[model samples]
Target chain A: MGQPAPAVLLPDMSAAGEVSLESLRGKVVYVDFWASWCGPCRISFPILEQLRNELGPEGFEVLAINVDEVEADARQFLADVTVSYPVVRDANGTTPLAFGVMGMPTGYLVDRTGVVRVIHQGFRKSDGEPLRASIVELLGE
Target chain B: MKTLTSLLMAVVLCGCETVQPWERGILAKEEMQWQTNVSEAQLRNQIYASKEASSGGAGASGGGCGCN
Candidate 1:
């Protein structure tokens, strides 16, 4: 999309802290908006974890935004499928509005410079390959 | 007359509100589904289909057999 990703500042779901998009400016970031009830997200999480693990040392980062109104639901979902990436909670939901997210499990590939290069809506098993390729290309830059 | 119709349409459209993507979690809840219980829905659908000799469409069309 070639648009600068909107600034996201939200509480980290894991620890007693917060995470922001600005902090990850130097890395190729995957900004994913997800909810516990989103079916595609269950599929997307593992693949995202795989990408993060494989490409992390190369400066690839995943910043997941959980949009669940009930934090417990998200925690339960995460308990079933865990990821090492920094997962933040946007309980107020202002972040998704800033991103103009139109569907669940939306992903924005933010290159090192903070501009969103790709917008992926809904995920399938086949999408992992292309998403990986995009991140790899961005990291190569 | 056209101005009055346009005004009416605008008034009606004003009642419509867009539910943002993230807010759809409530809609995705199990209680919000048309049939909250999958097994119960399946059983009801089976009975209805057997009685009417039709299935699917949620009452959109009759069966080809014209039994209805």
Candidate 2:
């Protein structure tokens, strides 16, 4: 729960500019690397949305990066499950390489100080329990 | 003949090394998958199999047309 997280700055999918994990400093960040083709990612999308809405007042932010070669695929998925959290695209997948993301729905929970507290590999409906505990613990810290 | 024998031996030895959990980061990449682009590849393979009347390795069972 104390390793420094790698730097990640990617083009914003919802806007015309770039957004960096650096901007989310001082806030607990849930950095999720996902792709449209991954089935597990479909499960995590709504969980992240609920968490972001619930913990946003406690300075929690979700930075979801989509690594789809075709942006339309991501958009289609978003149409099914929409999220208000900041969404970004890493078409070249360069950011995930730095984070050592080996799977489709890998997530890094960064504390307010920008230290990685957890690396969750997959997503399940029941996973939100422990994930919330970790987020709550960090929020308490 | 010796080179061919060694090549066969190497092929047999490929699966001997078990990848450790910590060393699986590279092994987990999307591109490292057998089907790097599964959806697209699946559709393409299906179309090819249907057209050619020969289909295998598509993972799904063949349809009534005998396509893979």
Best by TM-score: 1
For all candidates in order, the CA lDDT equals 0.91, 0.84
**Tens digits of lDDT, candidate 1, A8-89:** 9999988898999999999999999999999999999999999999999999999999999888999999899989999999
Docking class for model 1 is medium
What clash pairs does model 2 have? none
Off by over 4 Å in 1: B1-16, B53-62, B65-68
Tens-place lDDT digits, model 2, residues A14-112: 878999999999999999988777778899999899998999999999999888767897888888888999899887767777788866688999999
**Which stretches of model 2 miss by more than 4 angstroms?**
B1-68
Pairs of residues clashing in candidate 1: none
For model 2, the local distance difference test gives: 0.84
> Using DockQ as the measure, which candidate wins?
1
Candidate 2 local lDDT, B1-68, one digit each (tens): 99999999999998698542223434556878887887998687777778767565455566636443
Q: Name the lDDT value of residue A11 in candidate 1.
A: 94
